[model samples]
Target: MKHKHAEPLYIKINSIDNVAIVVNNEGLPAGTVFSDGLTLIEHVPQGHKVALHDILQGQPIIRYGEVIGYAMIDIKQGSWINEAVTKMPTAPQLHELPIATNVPEPLEPLDGYTFEGYRNADGSVGTRNLLGITMSVNCVSGVVEHVAKLIERDLLPKYQNVDGVVALTHLYGCGVAIDAPAAIVPIRSIHNLAKNPNFGGEIMVISLGCEKFQPERLLKGTADTIPIKLESVDDIVTLQDEHGFKAMVDHIMRVAERHLIRLNGRQRETVPASELVVGMQCGGSDAFSGVTSNPSVGFASDLLVRCGATVMFSEVTEVRDGIHLLTPRAANQDVGQALIREMQWYDDYLAAGKVDRSANTTPGNKKGGLNNIVEKAMGSIAKSGRSAIVEVLSPGQRPTKRGLIFAATPASDFVCGAQQVVSGITVQVFTTGRGTPYGLAMVPVIKMSSRNIVAEQWFDLIDISAGDIAIGQATIDDIGWRLFKLILAVASGKKPWSDHWGLHNPLAIFNPAPVT
Candidate 1:
């Protein structure tokens, strides 16, 4: 059938690319003619690949000027190249990777850029002044949630400056081997979540008093090498310490009132953009993610790095196939090695589960024209921009250095967002090609749409539209600058769509350790 774009249209990422993604919304039928004299021999779905030339079986299928995969069958020019005819390529070997090589010349620092932020005692900056309630284990989630609602109704009205109360509840802390070597991931994650800059340094914990992750253990100093003293007893309110439900809620509310008062005392101050810790992630991604939204985010990331801000790009499986492309941009050999170490650890983790990176590709990805993980990864890494990888953070570890950081976490969107939050990101920018209502309670999440259709359909959910870049309505730089400005506005307490609607996903801690 003839599509809306009667004239065939496609997007070729690189000059050397042998395939291009069909840009028509409905896609063109077989025998469609193109301006470049290329004719489709078969129907090509929207966002699906169309081969530019004939390829022999087992030959590399090139996209983004790299081998996304190998053809499993001989493919003729102008034919659809789906996952069924392509085999994922072997991952790049870690040894002999280029270290501190080809680091791009530093962009001129953008000065005089500032945002209204809450400066923490520890020198970190917070985009939001919030009171975060920590749970010792999942058993206390209900209690914490009840207390949080009470704080909103009974306590928040008096604490005008406090944005809101967030109950940092997760599925760990009980029924798990908290002493396992892998347990550090979840424990550290929970620990750092309490210290996220947005929480304003007023920590409160609700415990069941019987879970493996005791309040003291979860708050045992700071997870980072920084020696912040712990005060778990004063900050914790255990259910077992109370006589009745009313008494329990009253005690928790009393502690929460103290935190809300402290948090309310905090006020937004003029701070340089350098104090911002921004996380970049994508979820429900589609083909346009790489072409439009991600590239714009990459540009903004580079801008943030230029301003001496810390920008973290994560999702191990999403970037696994592109590891070779990343190592060469490391700021030093140590950073390069750290990147390799995390990748190897994840490789082993996946192997232990009897799965591989291929499991990362969801049906939404395939429907969006991504055939395999290899193809998806190339798009995913674009969010990092071209900044040198200055440092690497293990799962749940907070970032100590500035500039671009690679915080390794599972490719699951919720899990990745949680890790980033715990890693101390004050704000998050999430791009989606297939729209999601994902947000976080602790920090503001800026949602960007990769396609015009989704942007138009979800105008209330999406904060910005990079889809204009795909449809020739705007340039990547245009969207990038717009996004950068929006980030400042959001950081300055302008509520984003997610926060306006109070839509937040539950915290999904990365618990690699065993249950019980």
Candidate 2:
């Protein structure tokens, strides 16, 4: 397995898909003959299709060997099927899928792997180290950002070891119901920032003191840094508030001075692959994500898993429709039961909210030809690869089991990335079909554009353009190996393409279950 290489490839999603995904992008025309060593299907344009044989109106259209949709009206033995013109037949009645009962074999561990990471005081390892500044609410977000930016530009350049200064921000903190919250963005954001491997000490939390995020709770949750401190300013004096900001800024400078020794000494050390947790996420997906970037990431993730590393896969609603296909081999009965329970819990929880998990796709996904959550999820879930399900955890909970850890987070890309950070992902592999520039604070997002056009258009945001897959230039397996080594370089302290281009730094927390 490798992340970097060049070769043509195709993936058989299901035995029925007459068209396999084109890993190599060129030379094949709509009428060109295609073969998978089993069946000879005709070639169509990327994201389009070719017929396996003469078809009837009721016959299903297969790709990846599974039913993506059905032919509306068809008769040709060798004709191209355009996704735009395709329509699915009436839904086939579904029965309950049988649950697997037996414990599966322990998967083969990944081999010959090592990464440079920091050993935190908590015994957990981090991929990067930084002195972070946290905002208590959106009201003072600008102040926090100003203070952190000053440190990043002025102070960080002086410190050889510290990664840099990051100020984590969000859209909520006041004027909203803290309980029964519409979104627990602030808390989740802070929690995620604190958990990200990049931070090495207690962050300076700036607040006006009356916000929803009480200072005590925030401090209590974050007490690992050497010296924890807080500054609560009085809101009564408008003139005095300006003075307070200056005084607080001075205090942070002093606080920053205090942590300089520890921050400066932080260095990367050789760590086992087991200590690594990679976030698997996809956004701006198109027809190519499932076939190229998604599966390439999956194969890369499998390599990491075999080397004893953990990969966190999110976007439950998209993939919930295929739990049978997505569930990895579990370590034991306990692990397997946990995996099943997690899926069932999502079904019940969303139902309680009067929201069906199946309706989770965004407008962008629909515009790109995905009609429902099932199709989107089946494609997105491909990033996790085949591995054992070691544990299932809620957002912010650290993964104790190795291999694949299923983090229960919303399907939205940013929200899932935030939760993955809280679950201890040191770095992330983000696959996009259309294009997205989003990145999480503290965690380095490695963006891979699935199509050549999107990659060329958004080269600044996409770190790895998988356009080669669509152009018939590289096999997903070859790209998988390329990605694997690039990730190791990332773990070794190479800045992700996102960080190099200054693309992300937002935080979010999940507050599932009502706060009574």
Candidate 3:
């Protein structure tokens, strides 16, 4: 079913593009004529591309002025070009990627911007003063979860200044091959999750004493750098050590109160916006993602970089097709090569799993007019803006430098969000077109809608709308500045819609290691 627009409008990203997407609410019907006098011979869904010219079999279909795909058959000038008709193009060869060849001149510094934040003893800033109780083994997740609930209900009311408590539980700890070569990733990720800035330096781990991943191994070298165990591992709570569940709950409650007292004593102080570590990601994205929300995020990302804040953009498969565009924007050869290495590692990892980047796009993505990952990659990288990628990190690794960074992680929404939290994002800006209730318990997730319809329909869920850029209502710069202010406000203790409703999915740690 197709709907006709009174004024048939289509969005063409670039002059060189051979296709333009329909902009009508339900998409334009067949025989619809645009102001440019181009008649659509077939119905094209909103955000779905229309072939601007007759395409021959094997001819490239150009969108974003890049070869997103090739025609599977001879196509009409005005037909809807979809996944059924298009063949995805080959990804760029990693070996031949340009390194720092197109770095832009630095943006003018954005100074004097500040946020109210909780300052930690490790020189980190917390957007929330939370007591994050974690565990080395999933065997104790149930008890830790039980303890976190009790802490929230019984203890949190007494500590009014504390934001909340989180049970940082995951399925990675016990069963898998903990001694595998790649096991270090999820291991280090678990260790660093205890040190996230939002935790306010009161880190505690609940361990199942018999588990292979012991308490000592989890806390081995983190004491000096992070504000963790300077004394001994005696502070770690062990489930097996307790006599009963009641005893376990009571012991955890006692320890939680101590941490909550310390956390409650903490107050927000005015800190420069440069202390902000913002992670940008997109999920349930569509073609409008690149056209609107992602570009707006990219704009804000540049502003954050100018203000000396650390920003990260991830999802390796989402950026794989656009790696050529990103390599040249790297700060130097080392950063560029690091990006390639991560890409290559993921490529190998996927190969081992008998899949490829094509598996990254979801059914919702294709339904929302994303034909393939190649096109989605073009849209996904827009969140990084034009800032030079200063650093590249493996999944769950923390950042050592500021500015823009490429944190290589899987494109799964939950996995990316969890890894970003481990990488130290105080706030996250997530954009979507298919609309999701994807929130993070570890950090505040600001949801931005990629289309006006989603914004209107999910009004209570969406904090901001970049959909205006799709219409003539606003420019990317306009939304960018607005998003920047929103980031500052959210970081300064204002709750985004996700946090307001307390809607968050459990943290999904990226464990590429074996499950034996």
Give the per-residue lDDT of model 1 (tens digit) for 89-170. 9888877567777777777898989999999988899999998888888998898898889889988999899899899989
Candidate 2 runs further than 4 Å off: 1-13, 19-45, 70-97, 100-104, 179-189, 220-243, 333-337, 340-372, 452-461, 465-473, 508-516
State the displacement of the C-alpha of residue 487, model 3, in Å, after optimal TM-score superposition. 0.6
Regions of candidate 3 where Cα sits further than 4 Å from its true position:
1-5, 221-234
Clash count in backbone of candidate 1: 0
TM-score of each: 0.97, 0.81, 0.98
What tens digits encode model 2's per-residue C-alpha lDDT throughout 180-295?
54334335446545645567644455566677766455554422322233333321112124466678676666666556557788778898877787999888786678877999
Global lDDT of each model? 0.90, 0.66, 0.90
True-structure RMSD, every candidate: 1.7, 5.6, 1.8
TM-score of 1: 0.97
Candidate 2 local Cα displacement, residue 244, angstroms: 3.1
